[model samples]
Target: MIKQTFTSLAFLCFALITFNVNAQDFKDLDKSPMDAASFPTSNRVTEKVVKVIYSRPQLKGRMVESLTPHGKVWRTGANEATSITFYKDVTFGSTPVKAGTYSLFTIPGEKEWTFIINSDVDVWGAYSYNKNNDVARATGTVTEGNKSLEVFSIAFDKDGAMHLGWGTVRVSVPIK
Candidate 1:
């Protein structure tokens, strides 16, 4: 009787462990809804610049009211602020922007978008956003997107330039 009980208990423990392992494996196979959702986005790479844009679903609404609300610090998207990498120094809105990787953030308003260049890099999101580390800030105009964007995304223009706009506002950052 004792032998049988011990063997049964060991078998039960092994089965439980196997079940737990399989459960974890199954969980890994499941994709998050956010990850599965498709967003309109694109990317462009050139000898001088790499540009990306995040167009949210709300872009179909009014530019000033729908896409970017007044007096809000937008992370640019779910990830780190919209990012751009330049191969050489370039001038942005009369300010000289140096070549390097930088996080692009914006303060959206009715009239314009205040584009920010920060020192932080490779961050998971804007959770670590620090305004004090800002390298430069430039004001740019907002324009309507040619098509509707379902998801927030970034893309580069034909000229190796960066354009970020959703709703009613689009800002262009040139690559040197």
Candidate 2:
């Protein structure tokens, strides 16, 4: 009985210490993530359509090419693979994609960016990117925006073209 009591006390102390350490870790996160969505809100007449769930990574002190090197696949956001869901069949450029969920990835380049839709879902990052699982590929026109963007953002326009902006680089891909 004495041995069991001593063991229980020790376990309780260890658990308390572990909990305290984990609780303090949340404060270290500089950029708290957010989930952004497309479509109308409030009294807008446009019905809901596409949506994206991703972490908004900020450009605190990082360069665009340094963060997303040329010729390499970018998850598009901070954590977890960027998810793009389509409520209806849409033509991404000239390629038609069915209404479903897919992993959104991009290859940032100096001239243009290549938008990718992969069949593989629920992936963590570009580490699991496979060309074999790619469903569609579209070229996005990269242009310089008038304003400097601090955080990486993905938003869709009224014409169903989704735009991605980070720092000074902006790219758009038509989804309708």
Top candidate when judged by TM-score against the true structure = 2
Expressed as tens digits, the lDDT of each residue in 1-176 for candidate 1 is: 99999999999999999998988774453221122111122323224333343324333334445545667767676544556565567765567888887877777766677777887876655668798988888776766767655445445555544566454346665543
lDDT of 2 by residue, 25-65 (tens): 86555473867767543237555667788888888888877
For each candidate in the order shown, give its overall lDDT on alpha carbons: 0.59, 0.85
- Per-candidate TM vs. native? 0.62, 0.80
Count of steric clashes across candidates, in order: 11, 0
